[model samples]
Target: MALDRLPAYVRKLRNAAGEPVYYWELPAWARPVKDEKTGAMVPAMRNGKPMLLASEKLGSDLAEVHRKAQLLNAALTDWRKGAEGASMVPGSVEWLFQWYRKQARFTSKKAKTRADYGKLMDMLAARETKKGAPPFGKRRAADVDAAAADRLYEMLRADTGPRQASYAMQVCRLVWSWATRHYKVTGVKENPFMGMGLTSTAAKGNRATSRAEYTAYRAKAVEMGFQSMATAAALCFEGCQRVSDAFGYVDPDAPDRAAIVWEGYQPGVEITLVQSKTGNPVTLPLFEEVPGEGGGVERVPLYPELEEELARSREATRSATGPIVVEERSGNRYVERRMSNVHRRICDAAGLPKDMTFTGFRHGGITEIGDAGEDDVRPVSGHKTLAVTRIYNKANAEKARRIAGARRRHIAAIGALDEARTK
Candidate 1:
C-alpha cells in the first residue's frame, strides 16, 4: 500500500471549558488537535512525523481566549466523536465577515451603501495603521480587531442624520450573525463580533449639547475674525437658525425687507429664513416675552446692520427671487464666500473651544425654549411634545411639596416655643 497508515488527523486535547487533557493517540480522520501553548493546532506531515502548526491569531491577548476555545470545542465535539454534526476550525471569524460584506454589496437596496462600505473600509484601514508603525495601506479587514472597531464607531457619532450610526452597525453585524448560523459546515461556529458589546466598541454615543455652551460659542465665532461671522452670530441669536442653516447671507429669494417671512412657527418670534434641513416653516411673532400680558406679538423686524445686509442682498439679486441676503451684484446664485468668511472670523476672534461646532446653535435654542416656562409654555416655544418642551422645565413637584410641608411644621414649633416663654 502507498500509505502505511492514513495521516494522523487532529483532535483537540481541550474540553468544553477549555481545560487541557493528555492525548497519547488520536484517529487519522481528525483534523484539529490543540497543544497548550498554541490553543488550537493544525497538523502537517513532515519527514515521517506529524507536527502541529501555531501562530498568534489574535495579535493581542484575548482575555477570554480560553472561553472561546471551550465554546469552539464543545460545538464541534460531535464531529470529533464521529457523530453526524458540523465541524470546527480556527480563524473562521474572518471568513464570516468576508462572506457578509460580499452579500451586503449584492443585496443592499440603497445606492449609497457600496460607497458607505468603501468609506468604512478606508477608515478601518487608516485606524489600524495609526495603531502600529505599519504602512497605512497594509491594514486589511482580516487584521481588524475589537480595538479598531471601537474607534470606527467614535468617528461616526457626530453624523447629523438620526440613527444613521445605529443602522450602519446593524448592516455589518447582521452579516456576521448569518455567517455563524449558516456557513459552519464543519461544526465550527464563527462569530467574530461575539462579546463585542463587552468592549467599548458597541457603546452608543452621546448626541445632546446644552444651551449655555452654545451661547458662549456665538461670542467665540465673532472673535474668530470670520468676515460675516459677527452677522451670522447675530442671525443665530435673533434668527435661531442652525449655523449651517444660518448662512448669514440671506437666500436670494427672500424679500428686500428685513421681515423676510417664513412658515416656521417658533411660538411668537418670526424666523427670517427657512431651515433647509427639516423644511419646517416657522413664524416666531416678534415680541419680548412680556410675562403678564401673554407676551405681545408684532411684525418681525431687524436691527439696522441686519436690515442693511438684507437690503444689499435685494439690490444684488433684483433680477431673482425675494428675501435675498448678501449676493454678488453680477451672479444669479448666492455664493457662500461672504458667509464662510464671516463664520471663520467669529470663531478665530472669540477663541471658542475646539469642540463647539456650528450645530451647537440648535442645542442652545432648545435650552432657551426650556427656560421660558413649564405649565403652559407651549404658546411661547411651539414645542409639539412635552419631552421636547420640558427639557427646560427642571421643576420637581415632590421636592416643592416637601419644602412647603417643612416650612409649616417649623412655624408651628416656633409658635409653641413662644407661648412657653411668655408663661
Candidate 2:
C-alpha cells in the first residue's frame, strides 16, 4: 500500500512532540504492508510466528505506555523517512557491520579475520538463496530483517565448529550493523552476539600437546608401520614445523644456482617471510640442513627443520604430484582431518597413551632447542612465548657432560697438588 510509505506513515502517527511513531500493530517489525487477499494489515512472522499481545482491561500505567509508544513511533517515522528502496538496504547493513567491527574489543584476532568476515557474508548470501529469501540475486540487501539474519546464522551452525560458527556470527553482526546504518537493511541496534546463544560455543580452539603425549605418538607412528606417515611425523618431531610450513615452501633446485649456495655461515638466497598468521618477518634460508664439509649442517646458512624434511622427501619421490609427504594409500596431501587420523593411528601403534596430533612437530622443536641449550632457539621455533617452547627443548646430554667434566678435572688437579705439598 502507498499508505505504508515512510512519508505517509510519518504523517499518520505524529505525537504531541511532532515526532512520528511506529505502529505496534504492524505484523513485521517494520514491514507494514497491506494484505492483498483479505485487505487486512498483516505483520511479518518470525519462524512462522506473529506477535501475540493479550487484550485485558485493567488499570495500567498509561503514561509509561505512551512514552514507549512515542519512542516506537519516532523509530517508525524515521525509518519511513530515512530508508530508501530495498536496494539501499544492503549498503546500510554493510556500513553497520563495518562500524561494529571497528568498535569491537575482540583480542588476538588472527590475520585471516578479514577474509573470514568476507566468508561469513558469502555464507549468509548462500543461506538466503537456500531459504528462498532476499539477497539471493533478486532480493536487495535492504530487504533483510531479524528473521533473515537469524536464518543466516542458522545455516552456518549446521557444519562448522561451534567456536568457528560463533566467529562467523560475530563478524555478521558487524555486516548487519553496516546494512542498518547505510542501507537500513535491518534496523537491529543490538548485536545478535552481544552475550551468548545456543550457538555461541566459541571457547574451544587451541589444543596443546604434552611431552608424554609426544613420546607415545612417536612410538605409535613407528608401530603403525606406515613408512610415509612415520617419515612425515618423524620429520615433524625433529624439526618442529607445521606440516604446511614444511610442504608449502620448498625449492630443491635453489642449491644449483651459485647465488643460492650455502657457503658455511654465510647467507645464500636469504628471503624475509611474513608469517601468514602472525605478520612477523622471518629471514628464511633456502637450503637443506645436511652433512656438510665436516659432518655439520651444510648447504645453506639456514636449513629450517621443515626445509630439510621437504628436501629429503622430494629427493625420495621423483614423480610425486605435490608436497614431499604423500599418502601411502592414495598419495594425496594430508589435510587437517587426515593428519589427525594419522597422528591417532601412529600413537595407537607406538603404544603411546595420548593421541598426538600432527602439530607435535612444533612442540618437539621446542624440546630440541632446549636440549641444545640455546636461548636463541626460541625464535627458530616460530613461537611468541618461551613457556610454550620450553616443553619442546630438552637438555643435550653431550653438552651437559662437557660442562660437568671440566669442573671435575680442575678439582682433581688441585687435590693432587695439595697432597704432594703436604707430603
Candidate 3:
C-alpha cells in the first residue's frame, strides 16, 4: 500500500496480522478545558478521547480511513470556534437535548428511563426531513411551533406507529419544558409539543385485567411451573403496586441497587412498603372491617386470595430473607423485563387478552376500588394525585350494578308504579 497524504493526527499502525490499522488520538488543542466558572473539565466533543477506529472500526480500508480522518479534522476545526461552531447548532433541538442530558433533572432519572428517552432522542436527531435534508433535530427549538410539532408527529406516525409517535412527542415535550424552565433557552418562547392533541392508538395498552382473567392467568402460570409469577401477580393485583415497587428494581441511582426484602411483613397483621417511583409510604392491613351478618363490623381478610398465596410462598421459602417475588428457576428477584416476557407467555397459554399485562393487574386493582365506590384511593393505590389515580379507574360491571341499585331505590322512593306496566 502506498503511503499517501493522510489527514493530520490519524496514525497508521500494523496489527499482529501485519495488517494496517488506523488510530486517532486527540491532539492537545482538541482536548478538554477547565471551565473558569465551574472549574470542571468539559470535552470539546461528546466523546473526544483516543479511539482505535483505525483497526476496530475502519480496519484496513484506506479510503474510508481518509474519509473518517477528514471528519475528525473538521470536528477539530469546529471545536476551535467553540460552542457556536460545533456540529450541534445552538438553540437547536439537539442542542437542547445535549444541555438537558447534562443536567441533574435528566441524569437523576432511572437508568432504564434515561435509556428509553435517549433512544427516542437519537431517533429524532437522526430522522431526515427529506432525501438529503437535515433532520428535525437540527431545526431551532424556537422555530418548532405547535403546527410544526404536529407535522413532525405525523412524520413519526407514518415512519413508526401511533403509539411510538405519541411517546416520542411526549418525551420531546418534556425536554422542551425542562429547557424553558432551567436552561432558559433563547428564542424558544413556548413548548410546541404541548397540547398537540396527540392521541395514542394504544392508549389502553395497560387495560384493566378482569377478575376471571386474573384467576385463569394465575392458574395457568402455576401450571406452567411459574408459581412465583402467579404469586407476584396476586401481589400486584391485591396491593395495587407497581412491579418495580413490589419486587424491587435495578436502580443505578440507588445505593447497591437494593432489592425488596421480607422485613416489613408481619404475619396476620400488616405489610409496609415505600413506592419506588414516588417514594410514597404505604401500609396495608391484612384485614378490613366489613359489615357482619349480625350487623356489627367484623374483620375479614382484605385480600384473602393474596393472603393464601403469600402463606404458601412463605412456607415454601421458609427462612429466606430476599425478594418477595423470586424467579423459581434462578431463586433470584424477577427483573421486570424477564417477568413481563414470562407473564406474556402465561397470558397466551391462559387464553387471556393480548394486551393483558402485569401492569394491567395493578390497573385492575385500582379500578376495583373505584368500582366499589371508594371515595379516596390514594391510601390504597399509593398514588400522589387524584388525577393520576383516576387514569387507572375504568368503568366496570360492579360500578354499573351499583348505579342500577341506586336507580331502583330512587324509583321506589318516587312511587313511579311502572313495574307492573313494564311487565
Error of 2 at 347 (Å): 4.9
The positional error of residue 165 in candidate 3, measured at the CA in angstroms, is 1.6
Clashes of 2: 40
Give candidate 2 regions above 4 Å deviation.
1-165, 184-191, 194-212, 222-226, 249-323, 329-341, 344-355, 367-374, 382-423
Q: After superposition on all CA atoms, what RMSD does each candidate show versus the true structure?
A: 21.5, 20.1, 12.2
Alpha carbon lDDT of each predicted model? 0.38, 0.44, 0.67
Candidate 1 per-residue lDDT, tens place, 1-423, comes to 222222223232555677643322333443445433323233433322232222212212233333333333342342233212243122233323334445644346343354455344323322222432432223333344566555544444554222444444554455545644654432324434445453324334323334344445544543442223434444454445555455523332432313222222232333335555444433333333223445655332223333433333334345344333332332322234444444445555556554444555544444443443223323222333223233333242222223323333443565687889999
Task: Rate residue 282 of model 3 by lDDT.
Answer: 60
lDDT of 3 by residue, 1-423 (tens): 344876678778899999888876677655656544323344444342211112224456787676656555554554355335568778887677767777788888877788778678766765666544566767888887887788789988998999999999999999888777754555566788888887785766578987668889888987898877787788788778887776675444663544445777776666665576666456666654569999999875556667677777777667357667776765666555667788889988888888787888888877766665564556656676323344333332233223323333443543445565666
**Separate clash counts for every candidate:** 48, 40, 1
Cα lDDT tens digits for candidate 2, 69-88: 44344334433343232333
Error of 2 at 343 (Å): 4.0
Number of the predicted model whose lDDT against the real structure is largest: 3
Q: Which residue pairs show backbone clashes in model 3?
A: 22-54
